[model samples]
Target: MSDAKLQSVLSSLSQVARQLEAVPSGRPAPDASCVKLNTNENPFPLPTIIMQSAIAALERQYLYPEDDNISLREAAANAYGVSNDQVIAGNGSSELLGLIYRAFLAPGDSVAMMSPGFSFNRKLAMSQGAQFLEIGWGEAHSLPIEQLLSGPAKDAKFILLANPNNPTGTFVPVADIERLLAQSDRLIVLDEAYVDFAPDNGLRLIDHYSNLLVLRTFSKSYAAAGVRVGFGFGHPEIIGRLRNIQNVFNMNVIGHAVGISVLAHRAAYAENHKHIKHERQRVTLALLQLGFSVIPSHANFLLAHVPAEQDGSWWQAALERQKILVAFFPDKGLQNHIRISIGTKEQMDAFLAAARDISGSLKMPSARRWAASGSASALRGR
Candidate 1:
C-alpha cells in the first residue's frame, strides 16, 4: 500500500488498465418514479412466457448451466438461416467483441471504426492491446467509405460498424456494405445492435462476403438486456476462433431460456418495435418543429442537434430536474447535441411538454464554447 509499491504495480499494469477510467457512478437502476431515457433500454415488457421460464429456471440453478449454449446457438442459426457451426453465444455482444480481440489481436494488430462510434469498441480494442483506428463520419452522417477502403485501413484485422449506429442512429445500407467489402479484404464486424429497428440487416450479405460477422443481442429489440445474452453470425472459420476464447458457460440458464423464447416469439417483439419506431418518428418531428435538426434514424432513438438558442448541457440538466433522463455527449463535437432514447408515447409527450415549458428561460451552455467545437459547426451545418 506504500507509494513505491503502488507505483511499481501501476507501471506493470496493461495499457488498457492505465487508460481505463472509472465510469461516473449513478443510481444502480433507474428510479422507479423517473422517466428513464438515458440508456437505450426497450421500454416494452417481455412476454409472459419469458417471465414464467425465468421462474422455472430457478429450480435448475442447483445444476451447472448448459455450457457453450448449443441450444441458443442453433436457435440463432435457425433465425438467421445459417449453419449451427457459424454461431456462438456470449454473455452479451460486448463480451463477444472482447473475444474477438482476445482471440485475434496481437500487440500491433488494429481495428478500424468510425469517430463517435460505440465507445466500447475502442475501449475493448485498447484493453486487448490492439491499436484502434478511427475515421470521421462522412457527409449525411454516413461512414467514411473512402477512408475505410484506403490502404491504411486494409491492414486492420477488422472494422467495427454499428449499422443503425449508436448515438446517431444512421444506417449504412447493404449496398454501402457491399462497396466496403469489394474494396477491402479485411474482416468487417457489423454490430447490428439496433438492426431490429432498421429496414435491413447485414445477414443477407453473408452469402456474398466471407469476411462478414454480424452480431445481435437479446437486449435492445427483444427487451431482455437484464438477461445479458448475445450471439454472432459469421463464417465458421472466424466463429470457430471466437469460440476458442469463450468460456464454456458464458450464457447462463435463464439467458438461454429467454433467448429461445424471444426467437420463438419474434412476432410479439416486432409488434412492440413497430410502436417504438413510430414513437421515434414522432419525437424526431417534434424536435424538428422546435428548431432542432434531428438526424434521421433507423433505431429506437434520435440524435437531435440542439438549437442555437439552447445547449444540450442545459437541456440535459433541465430534463433531469423534470424527472426525465437522456444521454448527453460533452465532447467538442457532441456538446450541442442530445441523444434521447425513444420511450412510450406517454413518456415522449411529457418530454415534449417539458421542452416547451423550459424554452422560455433555459440558459444554454456558452456560445463561445460551442464556436470552439468543430463538431458544433459540422453537425449544425448538416
Candidate 2:
C-alpha cells in the first residue's frame, strides 16, 4: 500500500474509527498470587446465590438470552424506588456512557469534564466525535462547582461527573450537584461507579432532576466485574431514549442471571462493603502518616500523590519490582499519583509493608502538607 493510499483510506474512516486507541493500562488485573489492589474490584468471593445462579444459567447458553431484563432491572428500580421504565441496562457502564453520547451528542458538539477524572470519559467523547472542555483541579482536589456554573461550561450539550471519581478518587457532594443543576441546563451524567463505598450517592436524586442520569456497575461493588452488568437511572424520557439505542440482546444469558442473583441478595454482601470502607480508612491514614499527599477518598481507591521530591514513577517501579501492581498515570495532573484500590485487609497490610520497604527509612515523612496547609484530617478524629 502506498503512503498516500493508506492516508486516504484512513481519512475515509469515521471520526470515531480514526481516533480510537488501545485502552490505557487495560483494566489493571494483577496476578493471582500478587496482592492485587490495582483494580477497584471486590476482593471477596461471589455470594453463594450469585454463584449458583450463574452456574445454573450455563444450561441455557445453547439458546440466546431472553431479552427479559425484567428481574434485574426491577431489582435495581426497587433498590432506588424508580419504575422500571426509568431504567436501562448495558454490558457495562462504559456502554451506557456511549449510549448517552449516541442519544445526545451531535458530531463536534462539546462536553464538560474534569481533569484527573475518569480519563475514559475523554476518550468516550472523542470516540463519539464530540469535544470536551476540561476543568483541571489542583492539589486541593476541590470540585469545580463554581467553574462548571460559569460561562466556559454552561453551553456544553452534556457533562460527565464521576462522583467518588476515578484515579483521583475525590467526590463532589450531592448538595453541590443540586446547586449546579439549578444553574445549568446541560445533561449531568453522575457516574457513581464507586458510589457503593461512598457515604452518599446519586440514586435518590434522579426523580428530582430531569437532566440527571446516574450510572452504576456490578464491576466494583457487586463482585461481578466478570459478569459485565451496568445500568443507568434517570427521568423516563432520557432512559427511554437510551433504550432505543441499546442492543436488545446486549446482555448475555449467564451475565443476566448473575446480575439478577446479585441484586436480589444485595444485603448478603454488606459485610464486604463495610470491610472495604474500614480498610480504606486504614490505608488513607497509613499513606498520610508516610507524608504521601493523600486525597481523602469516598471510593474503592485512594489517590496518593507522591511528593515531587520522591517521584511517583520510581515508587511504582519499586512496587512492580516487588510483584505488586497499582494504577499509575502519566497524565501531567496525575503523574505524581498512584491509585491504590481498596482490597482485603490482608492485601492492604501487604501493600503498606511493601511501600515501607520501598521507602527504606525507619522514620516516615511528616504530614507537612496536611498539617501546615490546614487541608483536612486524614482519618484520625474524623
Candidate 3:
C-alpha cells in the first residue's frame, strides 16, 4: 500500500489503540541448560494419571471443546465446594481478569489494585482507558483497609488483591480481606494464584460476601502452567455475567481433560507442594546468609533485595553469565530487588553457588556495567 493508504488505515484506529505501541520482537527463549528461576513456574511433571488424561483428550481433536467449559466448570465446582453457576472457567485466570475489566470498566472509569501486584492489570486498565489506582500495602505488607475503603479506591469499579501478592510474596491475613469485603460494596477480585503455598485462603468468604470473587490456577502448586487452567469463583450473578461475555471454546480439549483430572487427583500433588515449600524455605535461608534481605514469603518464589554493592540488574547480568536466570524488575522501589522462583534442589544449589560467587566478587569500587551482548544493561538499553 502507498504511504497515504497506510496513514488512512492508521488514522481509523481508536485513540487508546493508537497510544499503545506494538510489542517489539523479544529475544529467543533462554538456553535449556540455564537454570531458569525468572518466572514462577513449578518445574515438575504432572501425575501419571493426569498425563494419561491429557493424552486421552487427543481422541477428541476433531471436536470443539465443551461449550462454555461446562464439564470443567462442574469439576471445579465439585472440587471447590461451589455450585456450577458460581464458577467460571477460563484458559487462565488472566483471561477471567480481562473479562472482568471489560464487564465492569469503560473509558474514564477507575480500578484499583494492591501496589506492586500483578503488572498485567495496569495494561488491562490502560486498554480500557480506565484510571489504575495502586494502593500501597500497609505496615509489614498488611492490607491498608481504611485507605482502600475511604481513599481514591473507594470510587473504583472494582478492587484487586492478590493474596501472597506477586513480586513481594507477602500474604495479608484472610480476616483483613474479610473485613474489607464487609465494609465495602465494591467488587473485590482476590487472586489466589499462590494460595496453595500460603497459610490460609479467602475462598470461604465467598459464601458470605456477594462482592467477593476468588481466582485460582493450577499453574503454581499443581504444575500445570503450560496447560493454562484457571478458575474464578464468586456469586452466581457476577460469575454468570463474566461467563456470558467469555469467548466460546476458550480452552482446548487437553486443558479441559487435564483440568478435570487434576481436580480429581489434587491429593496426588501433596508431595510436590511439600517439595516447593521446602525449597522456598531453604533458598530463603541461603539468600539471608549471603547478605540478601528476603521478605518472608507465602508463595513459591522469593523477592530479595540485592546486596548493597550492586543493584538487581547487575546481579541479574552476573548470574546470567553463570547460566542462572532469575527475575529482575525495573519498577519503582524494585530496582534493587530480584525475584527467584523455587525450583528443584539442584537448581537452587546452582543458584546459591552462583549467588555466592557474585556476592564475594562485589569488591569493585562501584557497580560495574556488564558490556557483553545480551547483558541486562544491553537488553535494557542502559
Candidate 4:
C-alpha cells in the first residue's frame, strides 16, 4: 500500500487514541502501598472454592476452552432461573455491551442513554457510527421514563439503562421500568452490573418483556472482575443474534471454571453482597453526618456532593496524598461530587478521616463557591 493510503486509514483512529489518552491516571495502586478506592472492585478476595477451581484449570492449560462454554452458561441460567439458551457469556460485561451494540446498531440508527451515566455506552455507540442520544436524567440520576416514553426518540434502536447506575448509584423503580418496557418497541438493554448490590433485581422482568435484555458481571459481588466473566439474558432469538456476532471462544477455560464454581457456592458471594450493602448504608449515613449531601444509593458506590469551592483539584490531590482514592467526573452535573466505592468498614473509616481532614483545610472562598453553586439542590433526594 502507498504511504498516503496507509495514512488515510490510520487517520480515523487519531480521535480514539486521544479519547483514551484523556482518561485520568489518578487511580491508586492495588498493592499494599495504596488505599485503593478508585475502582469499584470488591475489597475482599475471592472465595477459596473459586480459587481452587481456577487452579485446577491450570492443569489443562494446553487445551482450548470449550467453544460453547455450555457448563458456564448452564450455571448462569440456573442461577437466574432462565433457560440455558437465554444466557450468553463474554469476557466481561464491557465486552458484552460492545457485542450488543455491534449486533443491533447500524450507522445513523439512534441509541438513547441517560446522561452522566456510564461513559462506556456513549463511546460504544459512537464507535459503531450510531447516533448516541444522551438525555439528561434529572438531578436524582433516575431515568426520565415519562419523557422517554412520550418523546420523539421513543423508537430508537436501543436504550441502555443502568439499574443502580454507576457513579451516581441511583436506580429506577420496577414500576417505572415496566412503563418503559410497555411503551418501548425497540430493545431495552438493562445493565445490571451492580444489581447484586441492589435490594431487588430485574431478572424477574425478563420473561415478561421480550424486548428487555439484562447484562450482568461476576466482578462485583463474586470478586471476579479480574477473571473477566459476564453474561446477558434475553429472548432466545435475541441471544441467537448476539451469538452469531460473538467470538467462537469468548470464555476461556479458567474463566468458565471459576464462574461455575462461584455460582455453585453462592453462600460466600451472598454474604459479601450483604456486607457491602450494609457498609454502603453505614457510609451514606456517615457522609451525611459530616454535612456532605449524598445521593441515596442502592449499589456498591456512593456519589456524595462535595463543595464546588472546595477546590476539587486540591481535594482529590489531598486524598491521593493520604493514599485515599475516589472517582471524580468532569461533567458539570458531577463536578462537585466524588464517587466512592464501598470497601471494608476499616477502609471506609480511613476514607472518612481523609475527607474530614480535607474539609477542615478548605478555604472560605471555596465554601462560598460551593454555596453559590446550588450544591444542596443538586443532591436533593426524591
What candidate 1 gets wrong by more than 4 Å, as runs, is 14-16, 21-30, 363-382
Backbone N/Cα/C clashes per model: 1, 0, 0, 1
lDDT of 1 by residue, 237-319 (tens): 99998997788788778988888888887887767888998999889888888878898999888888888855787678767
Between the candidate structures 1 and 4, which one is better when assessed by TM-score? 1
lDDT, model 3, position 191: 99
User: Candidate 2: which stretches are off by over 4 Å?
Assistant: 1-8, 21-32, 137-140, 361-382
lDDT of 2 by residue, 252-365 (tens): 988888888887788998898999889988999888877787888888888898754655665676677567778888888676788888988888888999887655431335
lDDT of 2 at 106: 82
Candidate ranking (TM-score, best to worst): 3, 1, 2, 4
TM-score of 1: 0.90
Residue 379, candidate 4: C-alpha displacement in angstroms: 24
What do the candidate models score in CA lDDT, each in turn?
0.82, 0.81, 0.91, 0.81
| TM-score of each prediction | 0.90, 0.87, 0.95, 0.87
lDDT of 2 at 159: 81
Of 1 and 2, the candidate ahead on TM-score is 1
lDDT of 3 by residue, 321-347 (tens): 899999998999899999999999999
**Which 10 consecutive residues of model 3 have the lowest summed lDDT?**
365-374
lDDT of 4 by residue, 263-307 (tens): 889787777888898999888888887677888888889988875
lDDT for 373 in candidate 3 is: 36
